[model samples]
Target: MKKNTEKTVNIWDRLRQSDGQSAVPTDQPWPKIWQGAEGLGQDFEPDVEAGLKRLKAKIHAMPVAGARIRRLTPLARWTRTLAAAVVAGLLGWGIYLLVQPATPVATWAEITTQAGEQKAVVLPDGSKIALNSASSLTYRTDMNEAAERQVQLIGEAYFEVERRPAQPFKITTRQAEVEVLGTSFNVRARAEETTTEVEVTQGKVAVHHLIRDEKVVLAAKEAVLVANDQPLVQETSPHLNRQAWRTGRITFRETPLEAALPLLEHYYNVTITWQKSAAPACSITGNWQNDSLTEVLQAIAAYTGITVKQLTADTYQLSGICK
Candidate 1:
């Protein structure tokens, strides 16, 4: 029975130590200061009640006036409770604001095609771009923004830009800057070529030379050739065969023999050279179906009287005097 009584006393002592009372008075001006906080004291209801009970028990158990033991009263304990509530409220509000998702922003997409591969992409602005083999184009989907209507192209691409007079569409490339109000144009800037070429199909396009600060305006069915280093513009005879590349077709209408070799090399991915001591100049006009490079070469050989022989996988020698 004695041991049971001692155990009960030990448990109560532990509880008192764990929930100790404050050392300040309750009726001081500090309590009124807490009330002056505009209901900040109201936020401490749970803590104030718990602390008040602890203070009451402590004051009842405290020794007489001559003793050194300190006691806790209401107002001082309430001040501490209010401070804790304010900190917790701010922390809670901060956590709530942090967990919300951020608003999405406009973005751009880049389209590219490898060698021997082509792709057609429709942009968010309803403009269509037919990327040729070994070409790349970058455009923004949110072109509705004033600054987002521009596109950058590398290698070669055929653009059918959507018409927007207020928001003009611009295509920046290595050789020329092609800007259009609304039009279709083809840009080719191959590494081997000494000049960048632009062919306009429909509507009008303004071509700007980056180095020269000069501009050339081309109407429908017109074209311009720009040299790599020279900042000069020259009009060129428009070749319908050039536009054929967009459809992957190699069409030559009365093209010179030298000029035709490069077109065949680009399309068929084969080297075609003359075997004779002096290569004869010929104006070749023919249309071969976009099929195997061998068949196309064979068709050209059969009609043009040039013997076609394959030296390696990619090397083809065209030998025969023009008939």
Candidate 2:
């Protein structure tokens, strides 16, 4: 069973309380932090590039639109936070194994993307995966070279799966199972959501409902929304824009408001609502790249003669296009 959110939050709190304050003075060189990190892990070599990337992630997670920023009060606290967070992750899971004996667990590799972050990963078999914000993909250590490739996914990601004739690649989510020899597809399986979404960009995949004994095959440009414990069904994708997040460009080819709005929602991590009759006769076509939510809304509103209004950081309303 999954742990509760409060429990996870408490862990972060305890980690902060573990008293890992850095003692080095400001005059101390980068080598000191490097040495401290090295002491934490024997095999760790401080990679400047990788460290910068982590710093970038911390900044990126902060909202760009006048969002509040929480600063670590002291320099030592910042260092301690980083150190404790890493150590807690490495030690927390294994600590229980000492008290109770259990079967050996298979080694797994996990890649995670934080909110507002995107990651591109290459598997051992040359398969590629693009993880969207707030998602994780986990696979066995021997996944690529093994007889069968199996993976677990949570949140959203796009896969450019490698073809291994003897080995079948399968992805398991909370709501559905997907199998393919080689295909490019996107999956959205948010933990709190009852519906699992799959969109195929190339080749085909077989999707099997986890709770129900239902199955369907989806071809390129096809998609499906499998509700929790419900039947599996294939349907045409409302738009060919599912993988657009990876490219940072959402393409709309005469896409209707109903279809186009969801893509914008995904890209901006926002909620949008409009009247049922809003822009009923309007179809949109354009490519939006690295644009803010407000900017994109204005462009769409201008094109469709709709009025776009921002209600909150993550909410919007649309009107005036359908009349």
Candidate 3:
């Protein structure tokens, strides 16, 4: 061991003293030292020239000393591309959220009434609505001078809209759309019925059909009926009892019994079936208010000489002939 140590020290000393281009002295006992070192590992073989060539090539490829050359494989390149895309998407989404307009959330105020019930509501803009039985009125809570004042009605209602020429009041129904600057009107848009009726008692109103897209302008005391797939029919003299539900006043000026029966049924929410095959040429005329259904029926029976019988709770039968 001592001899081998001395030989290794001598080899290192000579390597340090020799210039890069100088060759080791052939006279030195180099073979004995190498042979002695090889005995320590019988399978060890040295390829000094090939190892030096590989190290030199690696150092030459580097941009600077001790700096590693990192080559990006296909998978690494794809990962980097995906990361950039994700970052770009995040930035784009952020920009979009910042620049996009905020959508306004609508706040609604609704009033509904059941059968044989009634309700009245005053809007924020001073418009009044009287909802009849089995009716509903829906409007936005934020209706003001700056916003559009629009209301949706189902069934029957009487509207006394305040005059706002700048922002016209609009009423939307199932079959018709009524727009007016200011008006007192009655709208009957019953769900069970396909036809919608709009009567303007005061001011002017523009009625438009939803299905046919036909339009008609109604003055005071004018009315229009909008039916599905039907032309716009404007009435110069609308029914007198159009607002009877709201006012509780019904007037029949020589109205035929056949026509008056339906009006009575509507006003009292009763069903009257005529038993006779042919209706008599009977006419009724009077103004009544705050009268019971029985009193009204009795009056009609006395005037037309028709027999009124209570068949059921809400169903009634009418028989006999006109006096």
**Best model number under lDDT:** 3
| 2-59: candidate 3 lDDT, tens digit per residue | 6767777787677767775447665688657676775684577899999999999998
Q: In candidate 1, what are the lDDT values of residues 1-323, reduced to their tens digit?
A: 44545665565556556646635433356534533554553546367888889999999997788767567678878998999999999999999889978855767678888777888888878888888878778876778775538888877888898898988898887777888989998888775566678888899998988866778899888888877668655555677677666775677777777788887787765677775544466557777656787887777776677777889988888887666
Q: After superposition, how far is residue 189 of candidate 1 from its true place, in Å?
A: 1.8
Off by over 4 Å in 3: 1-101
The TM-score obtained by model 2 is 0.57
* Model 2 misplaced stretches (Cα beyond 4 Å): 1-105, 251-262, 271-290, 309-323
The lDDT values for all models are 0.76, 0.81, 0.86
TM-score for each candidate, following the candidate numbering = 0.61, 0.57, 0.68
Q: Per-residue CA lDDT of candidate 2, range 71-129, in tens? A: 76788798999999999987976787677777545688999988778998898778899
Worst lDDT 10-window in candidate 2: 24-33
Instruction: Estimate the TM-score for candidate 3.
Output: 0.68
lDDT of 2 at 259: 80
